[model samples]
Target: MAGFRYEEVAGSIAGQVEAGVYGPGDRLPGVRKLARQFGVSVSTVVAAQHLLEDRGVIEARPRSGYYVRLRPQRPPQAPERTRPEGQPTQVTGQALVLRVVQAANEPDTVQLGAAVPHAEFLPTHGLQRAFSGVPRRYPGRATDYLFPPGPVELRQQIARRMADAGCRLSPEEIVVTNGAQEALVLSLRAVAEPGDVVAIESPTFYGLLQAIEGQGMRALEIPTDPDEGISPEALALALEQWPVAAAMLMPNFGNPLGHRASEGRKREVVALLEERGVPLIEDDVYGDLAFEAPRPWAAKAYEDRGGVLYCGSFSKTLSPGLRVGWAAPGRFRDRLEYLKYAASAATPAFPGFAAADFLARGGYDRYLRRVRGEYARAVARVRRAVARYFPEGTRQTDPEGGFVLWVELPAEVDSLALYQAALAEGISIAPGPMFSPTQRFRNFLRLNCAQPWNGNFERALRRIGELARERSG
Candidate 1:
């Protein structure tokens, strides 16, 4: 579509400016030249140029085509790593998390609450063709009811992908699941008992908290760094003091905070847990979504002797509806496989077959290259908007990748109250309580930056900031 092609061109040009390819006031190539470069019509280039002008990414002169705009003021400082000081407690606040998440799924509301990728970012046509071709390509896998460990086609593809994360695995070692949530749940069950204590990052994904709650387990909130991720020293102290049975982490571009652990820190985490004989469930759902290439390695990459259980999903990078995820549950593979069978018998093979086909035949790498840039530009734009519109003393995370921004409002602004107020105004935001089991981060807000940059989105974000200031009053 011309609309999408123009957006792509606009995003690409914006990214070039972000990468310093075009400095402020530097004139961009003429529309015709850009059209030739991007292989689009002259009209599409004009539309894209108009879009850049509208978004303030560039300015135009009477005869001079366009030039990058001068950069804006720096955003607020990032919130420091959290210091969660509390004993392991049974997860609470599920009702609130559920309520906000459910509300975010509504179609009419301004959707700044959910971090789901927009459909424009998905390979819609390619996936449809892949799905239709699945039956023709793999007739048996498409029709047959696959048992646990799923179809070899999907697992093999997953294994191949995992190689980028610095893990060497085979199809037999991976168990396909409904999604990362299910894979995380299976990993939890495979290792710990119902009443055992499980350690987690300070402000982690709410879904994992719910999973821990469902299993009747307690979550030990560890002190995590905004820049470095879960602290190895803090985790060591927690293990020494508590009877932590297993630990879960997000090594690459974690949710809310969007912290990416350095490989050394990752190795330290893996080693610390191994030293304590505690299993590490590495949730790497956002690993592949790193804005730049040479994708970060999973903690499973630095495994000493297979104590790390790596869980990943295509839901974030690929289609979430596909519900394709896998777990490399080292040392607990058999148990996880059996439990997976007992819980769901087998995941639908058709999705996996389609995903495999898409990876093999479709331009997944090309898609990643494009979508990564889109998300990076989107996140940067949202950050700048927050800086321009939000009240002073409001700090937020400047993540290198991932499409979620964690904002720390002024102390007087309670995010829960803000969430309610914003909902009344037909806007949805994920309050800080949704990401924690202990209801910490009373003044924090996690804003989804996955939506396209548009006038409506800008208005909605500005409105949210206005509501926050009103609440602060």
Candidate 2:
């Protein structure tokens, strides 16, 4: 307890800095002074100072005392609430989405497009070692076909991890898929039939749109708030007007928008869907990456009626190359299992075994702690860069979790053209229109903030800002 006392002291100091009581660049109290002030020993105060320094909250000069570290100015105002017309529209933009995906994968381009974590932050060596041992661990696993529900050990580990997100899941309810994409596709197929209307958040992930289109379903864009996610009122109105089959949403740290629906909003949405007997598919890929302490609760945590289908994957937190994703399909378990069998036959066994071993050995949570801190710092740096580089009147999202920022540029700038220009300059960005089924955000774009800050990344931001100015003119 004494050893951990410094964390409390550091937190007190961090609170002071956040409250502006200790302004940036202001020297903190001397160790002796702080010891006296907090009724702790001088050694404890020194530990507290070291902790603060490690968190980037304070710095130590060679001869001087610790001082609050200067950070980038507060980010520009978040974009306004989205106003998507409550109309069921056929999903398009597959061609543009394909082009952007191709460009994002180019080796020479600066990757600011795809919502993927950089490999440097991942546990590459540990995962490789785990993979190497998989064959020996399960002699025939490499050559065998894992059934629809996947490896028992992986599902068991996933069920244990789900407890952190406030969901009490069982290994039996979980079904493994190629990735979250496959999980999402299976959930969609299990719930809604072809030609049925499914409601989704406006400015949602492009991959969701692709999934909906692939299922031959129409998308009903709901008005979504930048901070609170989809509007419950808009969703209720849409439900009243249309014969909605099901709803898909990212209730915890949604992609593109990076908004988390409030628990109350989640309850309201869930209640409405339950009342209407509609299935709710929740994309929780970013749930474990919360920037702050105490990870936020998932939408499925409030589901008492088993109407929520919870989908998650290690792609965002762990290695995407593993392609290990799973879903707790609640009431739709049988249908989803059937869909998984029909779609891909079965998920590969090697990655599931590797991921399961990684989780069982407790490496996953430790890696999450490291990457969560990195992502928080990286998001702050990216926001500051956007504030400095982008044209005037540009707005961006301040995400609570996850590694993506949604930027709304000046109306005069066409984000598609900006995407082209950025690509030509060996940079990749996800244009705004790609996120919507109707291609609505012509002047918007999304940036990936997972990569560590570097000179090349800075140069890319500067170039994008210059291009934004040119396009505005």
Candidate 3:
């Protein structure tokens, strides 16, 4: 515990900087004096300052004290909250989605399009170690069909983790699946029938739109705030007007927009839907990736009557290749379990066992802490570059967590054209239209900030900015 005093010192100084105690280019007091002030050793102050430097909060000068790092110029205006007319529509734009995915796969391209974290940021060796032990630990169980409920070890791990999201579920309540996508699929099927309407956040993750389309359901786009999440007032109006069977929401660091709804907002939306006899399929795949400590709660956390079907996956935080995911459907537990059996049966056994192994051994919590900090720095780096390089009038989301940054380009610029131009330069960007069922958000785009920050990455972003400027011209 004495070793952690430096972290406390660093946090206190960072808080001071955040509170404007030190301005850009402002010098920090010499190491010894600060140590005296904080009641820590000079060595502790040095350690804390080293951490601040790594966090990009301060810079060390030759024979001079550290100064707060000068930040890039920010856009003067805030991004407008989306106000999609609450109308149910059939989803399209899967073609564009495919093209973006393909571009992301190109070996020579800068991967700033897909939301996948950079392979370097993932715990590749740790996961490999976890995977290698599956056979020895689980015996012949690793080779057999895991069945619907999956291996108890994995289900128990998931149930334990779900408690952080405010759900006290048994392993029996969890149904393992291929990924969050499959979990979403099963949740959607369990709650709604074909031809039903599913309310969703406007400018939502494209995958959600595709899932709604695949289910033969219509998506009613509700006005969503990039900071707060789907508007409850708009949702209430939509529910009153439409014959909605279910509502799919991502209250915890949602995709593309990267917004985390507040706990009060989550409770409000949950109660609103539960009272209307509507089911909420809560996609919380990115919940654990919050930049700050003490991860946020899920909308499912606020509901008790089985109205909220919670879906999550390790694909985003852990290993996507493992394809480990699960759903806690509460009252719809039986329905979702049967649907999982009918749709994909049991998922691959080794992945579940390996994932459970890693989680049980206490490797995941450590990785979560490291990965969250990595992503926070990466997101801030990309945000600074976008603000400094992009044309005036461009606004982007300041995400609370997750690796995605959604940019709202100038109205004169078409993000589709920008995407094509960036692709030609061996860079990939997610055009705005794909995030919508009706192909809206033509002037918007989302960028992946999980890539390691380097000259190549910065060059790619600058070139994308050039492309946007050309389009606007």
Candidate 4:
């Protein structure tokens, strides 16, 4: 440690790169300067530079000094790929999801936040196998774009799969989009116009809020429950008091709250909406991820008139990177399809074909079964951890499926402050205010239970609890 040589200096520099102290393309100190810093010969510094370059960690330019390559600085194993450059689109609701992921993935962050699945549990190799088989079957079509409604095979599969949930649909009923996010957006554009009053769950997916905001529409929050999703009585009350053009909801595994509105209640609500002549946009992105018995069908299943626009995606089940999702607009299918064309002209081709092949290979059901089992176990662990570490009287909503857990902390605890403090401790969580219309759930926080039981996650949860107790006291 007293008089370090070349290997030590090189090791130290590599550690800095791994720690993100030097970013991609950042130049390293000159070899002579490094030699002096390490009190080593220039030859040793040169050898270290050569070693780093050989390892594909860095590269040297002809005239310039050595620079950190983008490849080497990245973790040898990242949880999942992330696109960091996308600007905060004026597009609604995107920021809410992004904010949660951003907080979780930050360096050294304790990720008690964000609904991301554990990296180790993901079926990456299965997806790769699915990808490989795509080109072998259709060498020419694999690279070609499937404009608008996406691949026919994938759409057909979706239509067929809808039967499991008690919904009857022809392939024409389905329109593929990038993800459920797009499905929600397309439904919003198709049914509601600018300045229309769009009723939403009081504490809804913030992304949906952003979508409504982007369309220049007004949002009316109906009081909702943590266990049963939107309160039917509350929605009926809002409909009576206000002239709502359209309503959006997550009837199954509602984000933030993880509530699954009962079938009886869903039917009642659907009937009421029909009587009021208002359309409903049902976001069911997590419907298939249910860990309990066969999940409930869409509220649209009961409607004869197709007043419900049902949107879902394989992003949670298969692969998020594929960005494959679909919509069944009970009455507005044509409008939703056309809107899909106008938005992106077309969904990417390979991903659609690959997804279709993946499902057709008889792997889809197997994957879901495995995912549900793993997630259920992880959820149990998460529940036990919360019950043990969180304060007494702190309530939690138990989701039948999906990876999100919403915790209600003491009223005195400001989740915004807790979020900020948790970030400093290298942990990330979604603040309660982001999910509400009037930010009414300021004392709440949403944690991602998708992460497995690990020391890093456990410590982060404890830290978050400590902070909450301090603030509450």
Model number with the top lDDT: 2
Query: TM-scores, in order shown?
Result: 0.86, 0.87, 0.87, 0.78
| Residue lDDT tens for model 1, 262-342 | 999998889888888899998998888886677999999998878898898888888878898889999999999999999
lDDT of 2 at 225: 93
Better of 3 and 4 by TM-score: 3
Q: Write the residue-wise lDDT of candidate 3 on 1-473 in tens digits.
A: 65799999999998886555664456899999998999989999999999999888888989888977653123366567898877899998777887887765687989988887778888889899988888898888889998898889999999899888888889998889999999998899998989999999988998888889998999999999988999999999998899999998899889888898999999999999989999999999999988766889888888869888898999888877779999889899998898889887788998899899999998999999788867776777788788878998889887878889999989999998888888888899999999988999999999999897789999999999888888877
Q: Candidate 3 versus the native: TM-score?
A: 0.87
Residue pairs with clashing backbones, model 1:
81-226
Q: Lowest summed-lDDT stretch of 10 residues in model 4?
A: 78-87
> Comparing 2 and 4 by TM-score, which wins?
2
Clashes of 3: 0
Q: What number of clashing residue pairs does each candidate have, in the order they appear?
A: 1, 0, 0, 7
Q: Which ten residues in a row have the lowest lDDT in candidate 2?
A: 67-76
Q: Which is superior by TM-score, 1 or 3?
A: 3
lDDT of 4: 0.77
How well does model 3 score by local distance difference test? 0.87
